[model samples]
Target: MKIALAQTDIMWEDKKANLDIAETFIKRAAEEKVKLILFPEMSLTGFTMNVEVHGEYYETSSKNMNNDKSHWNFNRTLDAIKQLSIKYSINIGIGYIEKELEESKGKNKYAVISALGEVISNYTKIHPFTFGTESKYYCGGDKISYFNIDDFKLSTFICYDLRFPEIFQIASREAELITVAANWPKARINHWVDLLKARAIENQCYIAGVNRVGHGYGIEYNGNSLIIDPLGNVIGNCLEGVEGLIIAELDVDLVHNLRKDFPLKKDRRESLYRELAGEIIESIH
Candidate 1:
């Protein structure tokens, strides 16, 4: 499948401006006839923990964990996906803040919507950086999710989720492509590059990591968006501070061939892994 990754500059804490920029990119990708286009994490608003300032009142009244009746422009993001999909006749995946559940103190939730404009599934970030009150502002997602688009099985993950390898494993079991949307900074560029390739090699799946560029809340980012092939090669990438579309063609045959040759699934020692997981959970509890 041909997918276009948008590596663009964000409008810090400004939802409208970021949406405008994203729209322009999406239009361009459509003109190029890209089947799927991805946007970076928190694309509507730059990564900021000021929930009180940016968070919206998301309730059932919103009809889909979003209430546009309250003048929530962020809610329009969902509509944008549906409209874009219909207009361009392609699938689009973008990240945004959702309304919170009652048990959670935070009003913001992180979610990824599909081309049909339906929220295929939503993942509250499991690990929130405590430095900027992310934990206080956003609820955490408990489990990993996977979905299918045409012939390819795929999964979605936000920033900070990359540190955990097990999550990738969970998705890899069913997905041939794992798409990670992030706001990762320039300082950890190495980690981002390494992890994307590692995930492809270890899981035998294509890895598409879409990260944003520009500065936000004193944090500067150099968008190193990448599309890693199943054999663990960087096929397409954007360098530091560059903003544009990184298109790559991913073939399902490679993933199938690699898994058949390596057979990591059949070789896994689940019994030993259960014991390890038990020990870790016990220690945390």
Candidate 2:
């Protein structure tokens, strides 16, 4: 299947403008015959800690939202995205903030929507970036989530979750593709590039890292969006500081065949690893 990574320039706290920009990329990718499109985190808003100003509510892990058109969802950014997916006949992986009961903070979430507008996977960010004060504005999730599409098992992760390899290993146990939606800045672009390749190599799966390009909250983000294959090859990437689509075709069977040929996972002793990292696996529940 072919996928497109939308490296866009998000306007700070402006949902309307960002949605318009996202639609343009979706239309272009659809014309290019892209099956699935992935967008950076906070698709309709830049990386801002203004939850009270920009937080929107949608159904949490609800599959019936496609059939039942709620009033707020019908007019909001997610509804617009759903309409675009149905119109373009493509699936989408995007990120946003989920409004919970808390007034000051929200849940950082990434979702996969099918071509028919079905909600496939709703994953919340497991590790909030404490260095950037994301922990104060975004609540972390307890569990990981995955979905199946086009005979591929796909998992979702947010920006800071890329630093944790144990969760990636656990998710790769079942997932053949891992999608990361991020708003990473320019200063640490090297780390973003290096960790993405490491994740793909160590986990033996496809990694799609989508990021924004322009400035947000005084931080410049030169988008280093990338797509890598199981053997640690850079299959798709775009020039830094540019806003465009990074397209690639993924053969899901390669992941299955590679694991079968190498069989590196068989050497892992799950019991011993669990004992070494006490209460880590227990927290997944």
Top candidate when judged by lDDT against the true structure: 2
Instruction: Give TM per candidate.
Output: 0.89, 0.91
Worst 10 residues of 1 by lDDT: 100-109
**Candidate 1, 158-237: lDDT as tens digits:** 88888888888888989999988899999988999999889889999999999999998899999999999988899989
Per-candidate Cα lDDT values, in order, are 0.79, 0.87
- The top-ranked prediction according to TM-score is 2
How close to the true structure is residue 282 of candidate 1, measured as C-alpha lDDT?
A: 100
TM-score of candidate 2 versus the correct structure, residues matched by position: 0.91
The stretch of ten residues in a row with the least summed lDDT in candidate 2 is 66-75
What TM-score would you give candidate 1 relative to the actual structure?
0.89
- What is candidate 2's local distance difference test score? 0.87
